[model samples]
Target: MHKASSDTLRVSVVVPVYNRPSELRELLAALVLQSVDSAEFEVLICDDGSTVDLRAVVDEFNTMNSLQIHYFRQHNQGPGIARNLGLHNAGGAIVAFTDSDCIPEPEWLSELIGPIETSSVGMTGGLVDFRTADHLSGRCVNYLMSSMLGAGGARDPRAALHMRYYPRAGNTAVRRELACAAGGFSGQRHGEDIEFSNRILQMRTKIEFVPTAVVVHNEKKNSRQVAMEAFQKGTARIRLAREQGVHELIHTLPALLVVGLTASALTGLFLPAFSKIAGIPTVLYAIVLALIGLHGGFLLKDVRALLLLPFYASLMHIGYGAGYLYAFLTDPSTSVSLERQTVAAKSPHDGMSEQ
Candidate 1:
């Protein structure tokens, strides 16, 4: 690709990295091959206290590619803080956000930035495709994400025309000025992107969802990893609801059903009449699981994945339910402060790789 004029750098792609050096390298490699002019865009790697020095990686890419690559290091803050730092230091007119683990397509930047450059929209988001659809756990995660059944509700872009939808930071672009005015990203351990997008929307800025600008996200979570992620996501959802009062009924439905079934089952132990009532929620849960399995199987084209769907789905529901219940029992008045305290205590994870 030809280089653009140095005076007209149009886009700056900011990525947050924790400890995934190989993934970061892969993402940078794909970025260097973008269809847009190398000089038109820059890549900023915000290192969040990774054990290894990433400056070497950034310098190596800078030496080989025509595109400008910059690196910034910070304490063990979360991706939100890292992104804010990048935004503060960015020199381009538009800021694109993606994860260290995502590989953007050749025209990803060009397509994502088109609407903002050509239309009144201030921000644009694209689709994220899994690199491989062969793994059962991976397929299950993708299914939940697409359906917005669990933590996926926060990142779902397939909302009704009248409903509000937010673009995920993993594959989104925004005008620098609008992003700055929106206060960039909140420094929460999770749900920071959703909060930021909502702030932008509240400002009356237009946001567009572009399916053509795709990125490949390599998800290789096993059953245990999926379970942990589900639990963490559930916790984050409750925290988000408590902080923003944005309750997603769809996401909470499964958890509520699970809770109801458990409560009924427990009451049945004491009262014979409640025994029969307990079966109702169980039957309903089975039907939901069946539908989820059937849909996942159809999408993955693998009946084997369907066989494992119920187990994974159950884990997700239980984890989310537990988190919701925990948050509900705790004092809502102190949730915001508690959330910040929790984030301060925990180290930043590879936020970009999450669903």
Candidate 2:
């Protein structure tokens, strides 16, 4: 990588962190090892009201590395708000965003920023690969996440480019000015990335998907964790669908299936004549489950993993279905007010404070 002049900071990598210190440390270490010149970029660690002060970690990195590191803190709002804070404080022309849990490849920064610099594209997103660990549950989470069904086609390069699929904030980089002009990010807990990307697209800004700029997401989610994430995502989907369009419902297929199957079963339970009819949805659900297992097994190429696929898939579907239903039934005003209440309860800190 060519080194930039001391006076010019070409890229600013912004990471919004919560309470995952170990993961944040790993991500920082990965950033320090980027092929780009240390002088060409800076890292901004935005702490979203983590209970523990992450200053020690930032201090440790600053002391050991020549790369410039900055830290800021805010009361627990969400990653979206924390990121907006980082963007406001960033000095670089290019703003790169990644999660605290992701470890970018050595060439990630260069590849992600290259398109925006060389082409008319205002934004670029990299590929995210799940890291496999020794733990079975973790591997299960990885398989589920990387699978096409699990990601709802967002990770697929073809779909991303042609299907209007938006990139996740964790692996995207944007031209700082365009990002700011697009009104930055919203305070939504989930789907904020999609909402932000949609805004950018509305401006006719080119957003490219760079497959070479890869990041390994070390997500260690157990079965329960996976279900909880699915649930949260489902609820977020309802909001997105309301704002974007009914097309957003494509991402909520599993949840819809769950709702359909459950309603069918409940109907049969209430009416004895429809008891046999209930078996129709049950069979359909079973077939879907089988397909999920097959898809997961095909991706992992591990027969043993199939044993747990059913349980994990069921939890994912059921949890998401419940959340989606709740969101669908709830009043939009009520939900928005609740979110505002949560944000209002947390006071915002002033300016950036380096740890």
Which candidate should be chosen as best, given lDDT against the real structure? 2
TM-score of 2: 0.85
Candidate 2 regions exceeding 4 Å error are: 1-7, 131-139, 159-163, 267-277, 301-304, 332-355
Candidate 1 lDDT (Cα, 0 to 1): 0.74
Model 1 spans with C-alpha error above 4 angstroms = 1-6, 131-136, 148-154, 159-163, 272-274, 338-355
Task: For candidate 2, write residues 63-110 as lDDT tens digits.
Answer: 897877888888998999898878876768888999998889899999
Question: What is the alpha-carbon lDDT of model 2 when measured against the actual structure?
Answer: 0.76
Expressed as tens digits, the lDDT of each residue in 1-355 for candidate 1 is 1234325788889999898887888899999889988878878789888999787888788788787777888888788988876777666788899998788999999999999999999999888764254345665676666554433444446622122467878999998888877778877766678778877787899999888998877656777776776666667777777777656666566468667887878877878786887677788778877877787677767788677777787777777677666666675456664222111211112132211
Candidate 2 residue pairs in clash (backbone atoms < 3 Å) = none
